[model samples]
Target: MHGLIGQLRTTPGGRGEVVAALVEGARDMPGNLVYLVAEDAEDPTSIWVTEVWETEAAHRASLDLPSVRAAIARARPHLTGMGTRVVTRPVASLGA
Candidate 1:
């Protein structure tokens, strides 16, 4: 399985909007196993997203999805910076 973990930095008080956009856009993505969005515990303006997919291609393809495009449009205005992003090979999962 393929996985990605990334952090996004939002404008002040913009985390909630960005999180909502991300969550909404992630629905029904083909080959997506997990798409988790979280608020950073120590940063009011930071959001974390963890995603697991069947393949790297599946993950890449999601970027062209209409919902994802819309979400990017919505979130872009609020984004201030991007933080750590790691590509991973998922070998085990709790429920899998």
Candidate 2:
């Protein structure tokens, strides 16, 4: 599995827009096993995305998409965006 974990800190008052775009993008990734998105309970402006894809190619494909691009552009203005980390692992280990 190929996964991406992203943590975003939105500018105050930009949370709603960022959340909406993330919701749309999360629903849009194809063949994704998990696209879990959440806002921090303690800090509503913080967003986290846990995404798992079938392959690295699949995840790469998502990066080229218009919707994904749009989301990125929209979020860029609002996010503190420390950084995102990607991980690749065999499917079997998921059960452990």
Candidate 3:
């Protein structure tokens, strides 16, 4: 499985808007096993997104989806910077 973990930094007080856009776009995605968005406990303007997909290609294809594109457009204005990012090969899952 393909997995991605990343941190997104938003403009002041813009985290909620970014999170909303991401969650809305993630509602229906083929090959998506997990799409988790979480607020950073230590930073008000930081958000973390963790994604799991059946394959690396599946994850790449999602970028072209209309919803995904729209979400990117919506969130772009609020994004200030990108933080830590990691790509991983998932070997197992528990509840997913």
Give the C-alpha lDDT of model 3. 0.96
Minimal lDDT window, size 10, model 3: 87-96
TM-score of 2: 0.78
Candidate 3, 1-96: lDDT as tens digits: 999999999999899999999999998889999999999999999999999999999999999999999999999999999999999888888884
lDDT of 1 by residue, 6-80 (tens): 999999999999999999899899999999899999999999999999999999999999999999999999999
What do the candidate models score in CA lDDT, each in turn? 0.95, 0.77, 0.96
The order of the candidates by TM-score, greatest first, is: 1, 3, 2
lDDT, candidate 2, 14-69, per-residue tens: 88888888777656677678877788788877877777889888888888888888
What are the C-alpha RMSDs, in order, of all predicted structures?
A: 1.1, 3.0, 0.8
Estimate the TM-score of every prediction. Answer: 0.97, 0.78, 0.96
> What is the Cα-based TM-score of model 3?
0.96
- Candidate 2 Cα lDDT to native: 0.77
Off by over 4 Å in 2: 83-96
